[model samples]
Target: DLKMLYSAYAMEVLSDGHLNDDKLAALNQLRNIFGLAKYEAEAIITDVKARVFQTY
Candidate 1:
């Protein structure tokens, strides 16, 4: 189950790597690819940014 989730998440990341798409569209694609049923890119990015900044 963990591996399956990770694979789905990896696919999401791959699909989102291109910045040509708007954030909403990219996040929706990610949500669909991951079977997440919802878009939460803002929250995720906020948490990730906080963590990254903390590391500095």
Candidate 2:
């Protein structure tokens, strides 16, 4: 459930299909709020980025 929450926030952050520094900072802030470790967040972020950037 927590991962889902993070994923959702990540989705919004990457909505434009880009992960700029500001977005990264915002995601990092949210990551801290969710109490997820860097490694965990990295994994989820990676997956979300891939999905968000995926081309049909």
Q: Give the number of the best model, judged by TM-score.
A: 2
Query: What is candidate 1's lDDT per residue for 1-56, written digit by digit as tens?
Result: 53345334444444434334564476566556655533354455445445455655
Candidate 2, TM-score vs. the true structure? 0.87
lDDT to native, each model:
0.49, 0.88
Q: What is the lDDT of candidate 1?
A: 0.49
TM-score each candidate.
0.37, 0.87
> Among all windows of ten consecutive residues in candidate 1, which has the lowest summed lDDT?
10-19
Output the lDDT of residue 39, model 1.
32
Task: Provide the RMSD of all predictions against the true structure, rounded to 1 decimal.
Answer: 5.8, 1.3
The digit string of per-residue lDDT tens for model 2 on 1-56 reads 89899999898788788778999999899889889999999999999888887842
Q: Clashes in each model (backbone N, CA, C under 3 Å)?
A: 0, 0
